[model samples]
Target: MDEIRKNPDIVYTDKSGNRNYGYLSLGCDELSVLGGRSPLQVYSDFMRSFRDEFSNLLGETIMEIQVGMGPAGELRYPSYPESNGTWKFPGIGEFQCYDKYMLLSLKAAADQAGTVGT
Candidate 1:
């Protein structure tokens, strides 16, 4: 809706005709802004970020190899409310900032996604 697009925050929309909350777009540029890199490299940069951030949080340096050796799983959000519309599931705020910056390359990937959890 105009409210979301006009607002400073990004908005998600499944259909241009309907602006529901279930649509979750990945914004990478927001994450790049945090990491000091361009958004174009988000897909490849995510691993670096995951490793660096994990170490920062854990207070230990764990190489990508170590982390890669572990089982890799996918992380996704459920449907939820958007700027002014309500959605099926809420979002994770913890990773919002990261995903936002890293996903700017794709227009579908907006600056906003879910409610909060990151």
Candidate 2:
């Protein structure tokens, strides 16, 4: 994870100016070795790790988390909140996940925002 965070090539800037920090770039086949844990569990673990390692970037709290997954596959039908996208985790802000491509775009929208210099 540390290595992925340090790679400049992984940072993508969309046309709308949204900076997407790609955390994982793995295919489902490659990721299937996790040994039977559901996709929801995998996402939860990732979130926990991100919160632990990058708490400073997340600000006071995680207000919400949005996760997207492919329609059909091992990860399909993964368990998650059903709040119509308004889910909130007070104190923490927002986090968006990309499903087709395994990438967690961390949008650090706090007073302190910038790349972690290598």
Candidate 3:
């Protein structure tokens, strides 16, 4: 939590610079603060370790090993985070792609299409 607060580049920020307090997405190539590994790579390593350690019980004890993405493994941004106390039932979620890494990619794509400022 402290690291997220200190590193604004790792989270999404609103137009006024208020961050949503969510970590970078899986697709983000930016190295995470933990062990300087990307989130996806870290997840991969963890899954590999789990598989290796539980190889003997794969079919007997473990019926399935489900992998998930994003908040709660839903493959989406933490748009309606409950920690903020700003969201309620039926409330529309906010977009969460304002992180520095995403912004850089967006800028690059926009530049490629000649839509830098638009």
Question: Would you estimate the TM-scores of all the predictions?
Answer: 0.24, 0.25, 0.74
How far in Å is the alpha carbon of 116 misplaced in model 1? 40
Q: Please give the lDDT score at residue 98 for candidate 3.
A: 69
Across residues 6-102, which tens digit of lDDT does each residue of candidate 3 receive? 6666776544455665556432655765457676677789889999999999999998877676556766667776766766888987766766767
TM-score of 2: 0.25
Candidate 2 regions with alpha-carbon error over 4 angstroms: 1-34, 60-67, 71-118
Candidate 2 colliding pairs, count: 9
Candidates ranked, most accurate by TM-score first: 3, 2, 1
Q: What order do candidates take by lDDT, descending?
A: 3, 2, 1
- What is the C-alpha lDDT profile of model 2 across 1-118, one tens digit per residue? 3433444233223323233332333323233324454334677888799788978767456566555544332333222222433334443323333333223323332224665521
Model 2 gets an lDDT of 0.40
Model 2 is weakest, by summed lDDT over 10 consecutive residues, at: 73-82
What are the candidates' C-alpha RMSDs? Answer: 13.0, 18.5, 2.8
Q: What is the C-alpha lDDT of each candidate?
A: 0.38, 0.40, 0.68
Query: Candidate 3: worst 10 consecutive residues by lDDT?
Result: 21-30
